[model samples]
Target: MTNTQLIFKKRPIGVPDANTWSIEKNPIPEPKEGEVLIQQHYVSLDPAMRGWMNEGKSYIEPIKIDDVMRAGSIGKVIKANNHPKYKVGDCLTGWGGVQQYVATTAENWYKVDDTLAPMPMYLGTLGMPGMTAYFGILEVGKIKSGDTVLISGAAGAVGSVVGQIAKLKGCTVVGIAGGKDKCDYMINELGFDDAIDYKSENVMLALRTKCPKGIDVFFDNVGGDILDAALVHLRMHARVVICGAISQYNATTRVKGPSNYLSLLVNRATMQGMVVLDYAKDYGNAAAEMGKWLAEGKLKSKEDVYEGIENFQSTYNRLFTGEKNGKLVLKVL
Candidate 1:
């Protein structure tokens, strides 16, 4: 059998295009001892993938040219060679990259119960994005009841969950999204108290109107202008969780910093960047609590799934173009 893979061809300057990745097929190899072969069913498409493409000193290593594109994936183990923890038919999720099949050791790979949620959901709420929201809001943002929580990219994966968790904790949640539809989704579907349609509204004015009491916690995913606007609306002792900066991910120029950061000093607020990997030790406990909330209907999860590995480039473009909703997932098998 042949394994289809997307190879990293070039480091993108701005938005990645067709030239960024080259599709190739390679022979499926037999697993070595202590290794397992996974047939990936779905791979996660996240905004962070853009950062991984760049040569930089960051959280993770840059994807080298000619290597398979790195991604979080969920798959079933089809073959195991003396693997102690995993066996054939076991469903696993980890850094399986963008491939039809992967052979790897057990380290860093997690076994997820597909029965609890679909495989794609594992790549969404029950996985990295969910973990990001859980820790970013609770630990980094230090949110409390009665706080006004504002989230940029509020309709996307991590932001959506952050808003819901804030609501469940008795905070008034306001979401900022690009379009009317996404804004509506945050309010009507995700139970956000209010939403700002950044595409049509004056974001600064809208922030002033929606967050009349000032924001006590800001969970930022889309940075750039929206981040500056949110910073200007901070209440005393507010906490800003820098979960992502999707707005500047594809920029050819240097990424912009919040221009109105003086508001942080004036309000005595704190802004900190959070990396989910820092909270790795507590993932099981967090996922358990999030799972309970999901079961009780206190939380919601959404995944926007697209088909085919060949369609990867176009599907990934949706992250920046605001074309897809919620957590973006690619069905590989």
Candidate 2:
């Protein structure tokens, strides 16, 4: 059978756009010894993908030219051989790349139950983004009750979750989003204490006004100006969780690092980077707690799923456009 795939053709200097990848059809390969075959149903698009296109060192290896694009995907096992854990018909999530079918070991994959939530959700809130938010805030941020917390890119997948989880931890949650719609959703729908419109208002001044006592924890998804804004409001002993830097993902030039390095010394605050894979073992525990909140109507998630694997280029570009309101995913089936 023919299997469609998006091949990484060229790395972009700026936004990848449509020319960055080439889509083609190839014969589906059968599962070999110690491998499983998955007919992928959905794939996740994220800002981190842009970084993966560039050559260099990172938490993960870069996607080289002529290779299928890397992505987090969910699908059902159609074939399995010499695999102890996964069985045929079992639904799973893994690094399936951007393709219609994946044949790989079960090591990077995990079986997920459809009864828990939609399969696509595992790629979003109940998956990497959820785990990132849980560990980044509770472990790295070291959140405490009544602490003032601020988050940039507050409506996106990871940042939205960080704000909600901080609220659950008894912090006064404040969000910084692009427009009034996102700001309104953060405050009205998600129960954020307040939200700053970074597009229309001076982010630094707005953060100062919203967090008068100073920010105890800052979850930064967008770097550059937003990171600078958050640094200006850091309280003593503040902890900054570096979840992502979406603002610099599409820059043709060098990434702009935060210029407020002195804030760390002045406030005795700690700024550290976090990668979700570091807490892979604790995903079940975090997902359980998030599940309870979800069942109790406390934790909420929004997913923006686009259809057709053929539209992968446009779907992927949405991550940098701020056009997608929540976790952007693509449905291949």
What is candidate 2's lDDT per residue for 239-309, written digit by digit as tens? Answer: 99998998998888888988997999999999999999999988889988988888888989999999987
lDDT string, candidate 1, 90-160, tens digits: 99999999999999996998898999889998898999999999999999988889999999988998999
lDDT (C-alpha) at residue 261 in model 1: 94
Q: What are the clashing pairs of model 2?
A: none
User: Residue 146: error of model 2 in Å?
Assistant: 0.7
Off-target runs (Cα >4 Å) in candidate 2 are: none
Name the 10 consecutive residues with the lowest summed lDDT in model 2: 313-322
CA RMSD, predictions in order: 0.8, 1.1
Candidate 2, residue 102: lDDT: 90
